[model samples]
Target: MTEEAQRRLLVELGASLFQRGYSVGSAGNISIRLEDGYLMTPTNSSLGRLEAARISKLDRDWNHVDGDKPTKEVFLHRAFLDARPEAGAVVHLHSTYATAISCFEEAVIPPLTPYFVMRVGRTLPLIPYYRPGNPEMEPAVHAAAKGAKAVLLANHGPVICGATLIDAVNAAEELEEAAKLALLLRGMSPRLLTPPQVDDLLTTFG
Candidate 1:
């Protein structure tokens, strides 16, 4: 897609996620990899109100080249994007259920459904808490991204990446649903996808 098209799509997707409550206020950021650089939601900008033309542009080395300043959490996206060559987009959101799950003792969200395993891969590692926007979290996130498509930031939220913007958004949505399911099934033994079932999904869909 052309740069213009990517900008428009970022605005559209950001609005959709915001309107649906996936992000509130200026609490989330989205970034798309470009041939020349990247297009990212501006810092302090509400996803619901993004102007395509004003989205922050970063050079290949991550310097701010145009538009407003990029989110301070640019390093968060960079960690994943740099680690995974196939990842073309990264989404970080403070969605409720997912954030709640992050606060729990377990560092990983268990496989509760076939779709969760299929969409988010085999595991969702939890990165130890780092204050939001702190560059200190980058190394941990990068290391976790080496093996997982998504990771839950302890007491914060989720960071998800995919080969395309749509794929990343879809995975984020699925992750939120999986978190909801886990919360609802907590304290109750719920049927989970067995090892063979997870393997089958991975083999068939991956």
Candidate 2:
């Protein structure tokens, strides 16, 4: 895709996620891969009102190439690019439901429900909490995201990666829904899918 197209896609996706309450009040970031560099949202910018032209661009080595400075969470973006070569886009959002799950003690997003297991896989590993934009946080997320497209950051949020921008956004949205389901079912003795049932779904939808 052209640079302008990438920027427009970012703006549209950001707005969509914001409108859906996936991230609010400038609390998330999005990025897309490029042959020479990458495009990302600017720091402190509201996803609901981002102007495409103002998005930041960083070259292959991560130096500023165009527009304003990139989001402070560039570390996490770089980590995903380094670890997951096939990830053409990455999205990090403070979606309420997912972050809520992160606050729990064990912090393991168990695949108790079938839909979550089938669409997002068995577990959304929750890495130890790290301050937002902290360099250390990227390494932990990168490690946990191996072989998985989505991960719930402990006491933080969710980071999703995909081969396309839309796919990444879809995964993040699905993650939030799963988290919401988890919260609603907590302490209610919800009937979780059996291993064989979950395996069947995984085989069909995973």
Model number with the top TM-score: 1
> What would you estimate as the lDDT of candidate 2?
0.83
Give the Å shift of residue 158 in candidate 2: 0.9
TM-score list, all predictions: 0.98, 0.91
Model 2 TM-score, 2 decimals: 0.91
The sequence of per-residue lDDT tens digits that candidate 1 reaches over residues 15-52 is 99999999999999999999999999999999999999
Q: Candidate 1 — worst ten consecutive residues by lDDT sum?
A: 107-116
lDDT of 2 by residue, 42-156 (tens): 9999889899888999999999888888899998888787788988999999999889988987765556766567557776677787888789887787886776777777788
* Each prediction's RMSD to truth: 0.8, 1.8
Residue 202 Cα positional deviation in candidate 2, in Å, after optimal superposition: 3.5
The runs of at least 3 residues in candidate 2 whose Cα sits more than 4 Å from the true structure, single-residue gaps closed, are: 112-115
